[model samples]
Target: MNLIDTKNQLTEKKKHVEKVANVENATFMNIQLHAGEEVAEHDANKEVFIIVRKGKVRFIVEGEPVDVTPDNVLHMVPTERHSLHAIEESDILVIQVKP
Candidate 1:
């Protein structure tokens, strides 16, 4: 059993990304973004799942625009192109599943 304190990690300012877990089949990352911050378009090397913890985010997935809010989840397949932009100060959890 493992317990992760997401709130404590999310509030930290020294690092934008906090690694939650890294196992043989998957990796978990917690990411925080200030308003107007963006993660440029890129392809995922592994299947990815993103869970919005707070605020809102805009996602460009395969040329389609999608908006995500708190409690929303987005899933992407390996090699899919996507980008993220924070609509407000936001917190997100990213899970990458190895193929």
Candidate 2:
């Protein structure tokens, strides 16, 4: 079994991104962001899933704004253009699945 620890990686002052696992069909990542921080818009090459572990964020997907929190998850189809803005200090897990 492979074990990944994420709690220690969360930070409050700066943006943090780490690849926690890379397996045959998927890549797993952890992302932390402080309030007002944003990830520039980009296109996803694979199917993508973002799970908010804590706090809240605003997701701009294909020019639409989506508010996401720990209560719900976000998914995107391959090649979808998207970006993230931290509404508050937040932590999230991102999974990319290969086709």
Q: Looking at model 1, how many pairs of residues clash?
A: 0
Residue-wise C-alpha lDDT for candidate 2, range 1-99, written one tens digit per residue:
978988734444478999999999999999899889899999879999999989999999999999989999999999999999999989999999999
* Each prediction's TM-score versus the true structure: 0.86, 0.93
Give each model's whole-structure lDDT: 0.87, 0.91
Candidate 1 has a TM-score of 0.86
lDDT of 1 at 85: 92
Q: Candidate 1, residues 1-99: lDDT per residue as tens digits?
A: 999877744355633877889999999999888888898899869999988888899999999999988767899999999999999888899999999
List residue ranges in candidate 1 displaced over 4 A: 8-15
In order of listing, the candidates' clash counts read 0, 0
Q: What is the Å distance of residue 58 in model 2 from its true position?
A: 0.2
